[model samples]
Target: MNNEEAARARVVSTADRLFYAQGVQAVGMDAVRSASGVSLKRIYALYPSKDDLVLAVLRHRTEQWNTGLAKAVAAAGTPRDKMLAVFDFLAEWFREDDFRGCAFINFFGELGGGNSKVAAAVREQKTSFQRHVAGLVRDAGGPGHLAPQLALLAEGAQTTAAITRDPGTAAQARAAAETLIRCAFE
Candidate 1:
């Protein structure tokens, strides 16, 4: 990557970890600067304001998650397997030592329905993720309308696992999804 791109990436990567682990409101500019090893001036140059940086971090995370999910689905051999892969992916993610709640959801929780641009970006990112998952469900030959419900179940499961520290929630979600898919196809 070019120098500028590399610097911006450093900022985003650091900010992503901080923002995800701590609420957006809790993390400060100085923390980002220190974590990234970049000057405050450089951070400001890249992102004029904390809100801008927050939005950038959110976008970066959204891209990373979408790419990961897409790869997971693609690697699965069958449509049902692809659908099950979503839950498997979440189960694995929750097992990570640094795993926090969903970034978008966390951001939304932090903002608490503010009228900020970052809030809008978080909402958009969530909608986009749901749509992406929905598309995968459609490709798996499930009814077109089943995508939203499946997405909800998957997201609900993620939240439950994160909150309850129960990985079994993911397994149960996968089994339930398989049953739904079978019913839809039959």
Candidate 2:
């Protein structure tokens, strides 16, 4: 890549790690500059403002997550397996020592509304995910409501596992999801 692209990437990467670890509000421009080894002028030039930078980071992370989830689902053999893959994915993620929580959820928590662009982007990403899973359920001939139910369970599992640091909660959540899927199919 060119120097400009590389420099911008460094800034985003640094911001991504810091924002994920400390939070968006807690991490300032100077911290990002120091961590990225990029000048404040360059950072501002690339992003225009901190809010813009935060939105970029959120969009990048959201795309990364959706790509990972799509891969996990595609790798599974059956529709049921694909559906269950969400839990498996979360379970493995939660096992990581640095896994704080879902970045989008955490971003919203930190910002607490007011940024219309970020809020809209987050809502669009979430709705896309829900529709993706819902499409899978529809294809599997499960009940119409099955997708949202499983999505709620999956979301709850992520929150609970993050909060409690209990892997068992994920397993229980997976089991609950399985039961729901089976019931829907029956």
Candidate 3:
């Protein structure tokens, strides 16, 4: 990759790490520079502003959510298993030492009210995730209402896991999901 791309990635990764660990509002560009080793000048040149950096971080998160879910679903053998794989992915994420719930949810709580772009990005990520769940439900021949129900379970699981510091929330959500799926298909 080129210098600019490399620098941008460094800034985004560092910022994302710092932001996730310590809310977006708490971390400054200077903090990011210190963590990332990218000069503030280059950071601003790449992101233009803290808002821009925040957006880049959100985009990176979006990619991670999409890719992780895709790989998890791809690993499952059946359509229903693919649906359950979503929870499996969450379980893995929750087990990580750095787990801090959903970045979109966290960032939205932090900046969504004051920032239009951040708010919109959070909304789009949520909407896209819901659509992804709906598609999985469709593929599994689940009843239509199951999509929202399942999505709620996952969302609630993420919040609960973060609050309770329990990775088993994913398993619980997966069980609830399995029940929902059975009720829908049976």
Candidate 4:
């Protein structure tokens, strides 16, 4: 990578870990500079401001999160299995040593009330997720309309797992989704 590109990537990567681990509001630019080993002058030149850096991090995370989910779902054998694979993805994610739940959810909780840009990014991530779930439901012979309910269960699983630090919540959510999908077809 070019020098500027390398610096920007370092800043964003460092910020992603710090912001997700602590919180966006809790992490500061100096901390990002220190953690990334990027000079403060370059950090500012790349991101322009903390908000800019935050927006970049959120956007980067959204892409990565969506890609991971899609890959997991695709690896399943059947439509129904694909639908259930979302919880499998969650299970693995929650088991990660540094699992911090949904970054968008955390970011929204931290700054959604005051920051329009952050709020927008959060909403976009959620909307995209729900849309993906809805498509999976439709493909799996469940009503697409039931996507919201399924999304609720998936999100609940993530929240509960994050709070309780228990990966088992994913199984519970998957079981609940199975019931919801079965009932939707009946």
What TM-score against the true fold does each predicted structure earn? 0.93, 0.95, 0.98, 0.97
Candidate 4 structure quality by residue, lDDT tens digits, 73-180: 989999989988999999889899999899999999999999999999999999999999989988877876789998999999988999999999999999998898
- List the pairs of residues colliding in candidate 1: none
User: Which scores better on lDDT, 1 or 2?
Assistant: 2
For model 4, where is the 10-residue window of minimal lDDT?
137-146
- Model 3 poorest 10 in a row by lDDT: 39-48
Which 10 consecutive positions of candidate 1 have the poorest summed lDDT?
109-118
True lDDT of residue 122, candidate 4: 93
Model 3 shows how many backbone clashes?
0
Query: What lDDT does candidate 4 reach at residue 76?
Result: 98
Clashes of each: 0, 0, 0, 0
Write model 1 residue lDDT over 3-111, tens digit each, in one string: 9999999999999988887778889999999999999999999999988888898889888888888888888998878888888888788788877668777787777
Residue 103: error of model 3 in Å?
0.8
List model 3 lDDT by residue over 17-123, tens digit each.
Answer: 99999999899999999999999988888989999999999999999999999999999999999899999999999999999999999999999999999999999
lDDT of 1 at 115: 40
User: Which residues of candidate 1, in runs, are more than 4 Å off?
Assistant: none
TM-score for candidate 1 = 0.93
Better structure of 1 and 2 per TM-score: 2
lDDT of 2 by residue, 1-186 (tens): 999999988998899999999989889999999999999999999999999899888878887888888888888898889899888877878888988877878887778487877787778778888998898888777887999998889888877877888877778988999999988877
